[model samples]
Target: MPQFVRKNGFWGVRVNWVEHLNKKTVYRRKYKQGFKTKREASMWANKFLAKANSGELVEQKIPTFPDYFMQWARIYRFTHITEVTKNRYIVTASHLESYFGSKPLNKITRSNYQEFLNEYSKDHAPSSVNKTKGLIKSCLDSAVADGLIRVNFSLGSQATGNKKKKLVVIYPNVEQIENILNLALERRKPYYPSFYIIITAILTGMRLAEICGLTWDRIDVENRTFKIDRAYNHLATDKEHIFKTLKNESSYRTIRVSHNLISVLSELKVNGSNLVFAEKNNPYKVPYSNGVKHPLKKIIKDLDYNLGDFHFHSLRHCHVALLHHDGIDWYSISKRLGHENLTTTLKTYAYLVEEDKIKSDDLIETQLDNFLTIGEKIGETSKKHKIK
Candidate 1:
């Protein structure tokens, strides 16, 4: 049986649940709120008891999809996840909320979810659609664990994400690299630090976040090495950004730098601030990604490099490409880039590896041709000596 209660200008229903577990009876009372009127509450209570008696009531209550996801994020995710990750999750939630705001978590069946994804796929990329589905599945997995839902219905979607063969790796050649360095030294841009940032990234292959988070204390001038242990989360101009943990374990590593870079760094004043690339006025803080991007674009335009869609990250790719061209081993490049796995380096620079293989083949063919010519000359001498 169930009972109706009224409080805080709202009506609620209280129902009892009993379960038999290993011959032991477990009893619990579940309460649900948000009824508009007492009669509505009474009707719900009656309906709940009937369902419970018939063994059709599985969960205590079903929450609206948006409401549950929002609550879950606030309670379980906000503190544990990184700021960037939290923002991504929030974006996913907002998109899902628009579609399933009023629907209960338990009511979203597999067919319903599949249909939703099918519609979402029409407007979004396969990767994005899959990412959204992944997030929803994660949220629903927690719901299943809490006994809030009988099963995660966000599973078994037939729409699959496209497999990415390789990431696009673009970088400047030797002549271009030299030209960039010369340009940086030659030009005095309005954004003073952009050139320095570009040069450092080309030399070190550090990510934009790592560059923003770099501090002088982490740099060893004598050893010619810099440690990358964290990344910066640039939220706003007025608000102070935070230095958070590195992307992964491998991202925290020490990379050797050049003596030329060392000399340049030494010339720059440490400026009462720890950040090497900190803004002029706010010496304690580094510029945001946009701050780096705008200057980089301007420099590319000024130099007339003819590089399309070139950004700060392009410098990192350029660094990797130069190293590969200089015959640096895959393992060494992976370590220098602070990649968690060598596979990442191998996959990223596969085109470079293919080029190296072609060179090797050419060298082998040239040696084989020389050996055959020598053999032919020996045979000709033998025949002439026999004839004499």
Candidate 2:
């Protein structure tokens, strides 16, 4: 029989192996998890006994890190998460297969993980390497939950300590955005859901998937608002499109349509059943998934928008940037952009570094006008004194 008891500030695992011939042997090791109540300790005791009796107790060494990671992906990840998310997990795992595949679960060390980060992630930005570390750590943590390993050995790795990712934060100014929008509107060739999808996306910082999910049913013409209840995801073409809740509960809020967006939707008012951005002629069609060619990038090139660092996601960035230029605070912008926190909004749209300098220069021009007017008045007074 295995049992649990509190010793000093910890709950300990206690096991008694029954000898069929005569005596019994008891072994115990205390873990540092402080149980607030006796019930929890009792529960641990019951579970320990069950595992010991079934011979399912976690051994000191059972599987290699490589072996356990694959098992974790199948047993824990695939059934629980979104398909797109599951695929991403698989992709993250696949990249790791080359490095830690043969290493034993019990043997992976801090130095080896450090070597991987220093040798590989040093060239990459701090943030990208940080994401890689999280995914890999999550895989290993699941292995810990599965009892394949006792402790998370990579806890102190350099990648885990990376402060933040250094993403390129170059958003277009107002004139640049207008130029891009006008350019997008000029495209009548492929019949982009230009009138609805492209305009809304460029104006509102909602994700590409969220724009694809917009339906006429959810639109409010009278109030000129749109609800974002969910985001449409079709990350792969080989599979069916996926429907998931908005980025989070906070993302489910309503967003006011811009005047231009309202007018465009008015122009797009066909008696449609499903999507505002649905395929025009084929009323029954679903929109393109992630694998399909996103025409925004191509349109930029066709229009000769020799703009620098302009990606589709930049349209979202531009939305937040324009609001920032209009003097919206980070908290308000964070809500509108469906960010979980202000920190995220700052990370994404905090590129207004030279704002004060630009404003100062503009202010100097206005002050110069006032200064010149004073000089004219002073000269008139001097002339009047001379006349006197």
lDDT by residue for model 1 over 1-388, one digit each (tens)?
5677889999988888786556777786789899999888888778877777776654356788877887788888787677778887788777778887788787888888888777676666666777788778888888999777898887677665443522333456777877776777665332366667777888889998898778788889889999899776676445355677787788989999998886675544544566777766677567667766786777677777777657777787788888887889889999989898999988877777788899999999999999999999999999989954
Worst 10 residues of 2 by lDDT: 17-26
TM-scores, all models, native as reference: 0.73, 0.67
Instruction: Please give the range of 10 consecutive residues that has the lowest summed lDDT in model 1.
Output: 161-170
Best candidate (score: TM-score): 1
lDDT of 1: 0.77
Model 1, runs deviating above 4 Å: 1-59, 70-81, 160-170, 188-191, 236-241, 364-388
TM-score of 1: 0.73
Q: Name the candidate that leads on lDDT.
A: 1
Q: Total backbone clashes of model 2?
A: 2
| Residue range 209-313, candidate 2, lDDT tens digits | 788777777788788888889766555343245455665667888988766676775555463537666556754344554322356666666756565556666
